[model samples]
Target: MSPKSLCFTVLVAVFSVLASRVVINPTPQVLKYVVDFGLTISSSPSIVAMFIPFDFDDLRRHHKNPDKGKPVSVCEDFPPNFPPPETNTTLTLCVDRNGCCNFTTVQAAVDAVPNLSIKRTVIWINSGIYYEKVIVPKTKPNITFQGQGYTSTAIAWNDTALSANGTFFSGSVQVFSTNFIAKNISFMNVAPIPHPGDVGAQAVAIRIAGDQAAFWGCGFFGAQDTLHDDRGRHYFKDCYIQGSIDFIFGNGKSLYEGCQLLSMANPVAPGSKSINGAVTAHGRASADENSGFAFVNCSVGGTGRIWLGRAWRPFSRVVFALTSMTDIIAPEGWNDFNDPTRDQSIFYGEYNCTGAGANMSGRAAYVQRLNDTQASVFLNTSYIDGDQWLLSYDT
Candidate 1:
């Protein structure tokens, strides 16, 4: 055979072997690169090949996105350089006759907090009646407003629904856009009333609109509309909430653990009118399926006669689990909100509830006694299963 023909034969043989093999290489950056070929010998020999290149930068960007999976950790610790915890030292914020804290008001201290501080910052409020409306915005979390005492460190305001040109649903201490911790503080509404029939006159002592807000060992005092536990998920432990009419009414999902529900008598009553509006008008519309008002190991006591609860609107859902009720509770346990048709849509239940008021013999047939498994859902703060956001609370 000629030398050129021999070279051609050798090249064909080498190509035939290469077609059946695959090659993989790893770059110094730990990316995998692969090359593969498949051979067909029909007519003249032909080969099909493919190449795959891994891009580390594209993968890194995807992992860093918050909506995607958890962010990649560049450092050993997940969150590098997290802020240190705040010291428990007390910072006295005195609101004097001119409403200033060391020449600055209480609002000034709240606004000055560094964002996302892990430390527990306590605002030690001195003994004086503060008249300004206070708001704890969401930017400043883990803040504790500690009062000298419930009475001594009182925050008093007279912003009624009528005077403020708002509804009882509007809060006096409007806790919006903030996760707050309040303890040993008294939130009072000093609103005067002319008559009991004045339906529009409403005063909210503390309206909590922030999610995950907590109140510990605090007293909320007002006559008509008080302690408006408004929208969002909130926890109130070891607190006293007092009001006369449908006071504790709101759309928020709340867990009142070991709290006191007090009822102030209609100031105009001359010992003649025996019946007062319901103590709790849960007002949780059905549109809010996960929204509810839960009372766990709470006590319901009042000066005048009051029903344990009433459906403030159609399709309200409320549950009182393991709560102690005083004789002030009406025999019926729940009111119809003056609409008999609401009986079909209202969801009012009691689970392991004890006391003279829990007697179901006289309770409306619509009122149910939830089974153990059913009541467990309401006991915990899992508005949605597996989320466990409520567990983040300092119960």
Candidate 2:
């Protein structure tokens, strides 16, 4: 183990001892919508998770089914599962709405971090809805947004494509710096939901243009273009993403494991669904772009007849492995965006997936028939070079 890992292991042992002595009694009101964890390190979900991610089933055991409901006003404070900095001199910023911490707004706390600092700066956000558009600039790298819980803490805005000047800038939470980490927080674009064929209604909950970004137990909410996984390598584990048309779109080389992809597509009669929505719209312009989306052991469910993904760009690439899909998916598993030429280049495939929607009888022709060897390349964190920056965890 690296020195950092050795220190974290020691800290975990010490913290476990201290945690066993405490008693937790959350208020009744806060327990109803859990559908999850107190989250990381009291106020550092992203930090604790990266260093000590548990088993997938352990992560899934407490989660409520996405179709059942979302989290309401529920969150509980706790001791750090693993606090960083053996010394009290380490850098950490606290954001609380009532001014109980270093700052009130998330952006202000982000601005407080030193630019070009090699050490990671964590911003602990208290449980509350922050109505603001936050950005992590390129100059400041290694910033982490650790929240109380996915259901209790949120950053919200209502910028539509036209309102924000462009769809790319409409995200409520935008990350442009490298090595960004967010855990247990929900990013929401609360603009009005749009019709299936509507235009200018693209509202992005989060736009991650940063390299080496990782999100754990997070939430993303919107109607269209919900998550702009813009560019770079990202890992999202056990996240809840809700949206309609092209809900999860972008060019990022991302791996989404143990995630719940809840589709918010309208519930219409099967035959009446003419202008329907799609779950993903990967925009890989060239075969050599080195960007695509790989979803492993995820769950896809919700209303509307949705396409697994469409060839948003000519050379778009995507894969779903060991995932469970509902009948909400269109019979034709994928679309070529009405471009016959794209059918020659796009790579859309599924392997070992289950559920009615996973049936391949009506799938598009261009889908790659992936074998075990080919599927292994995109099966784990290795696809995104995660070992370099991410904490080494058994999961």
**Residue-by-residue lDDT tens digits, candidate 1, 1-395:** 64324433433343334323423232111111122233333432222111112122322443476576667643222222322233464233333333323423457667766676655565656544455677777777756776644533556565667668886444557776545778767786655531356756777778877777777777777666677767777878777777677778777778888877776553224434356756677766676456778888887775667777788878887889998887667777888887999999988989998887777788888998899998988885464232544333342
Q: Model 2, 238-339: lDDT tens per residue?
A: 888888899999999999998888776668775664547899999999978999999999988877888989999999999999999998887778899999
The per-model lDDT (C-alpha) reads 0.63, 0.77
lDDT of candidate model 2 versus the reference: 0.77
Badly placed stretches (over 4 Å) of model 2 are: 1-90, 270-275, 392-395
- By summed lDDT, the worst window of 10 consecutive residues in model 2 runs over 28-37
lDDT of 2 at 318: 96
Off by over 4 Å in 1: 1-104, 114-121, 138-142, 168-170, 193-195, 266-274, 380-395
| TM-score versus the correct structure, for each prediction | 0.68, 0.78
Clashing pairs in 1: 85-119, 86-119, 101-104, 137-178, 138-177, 138-178
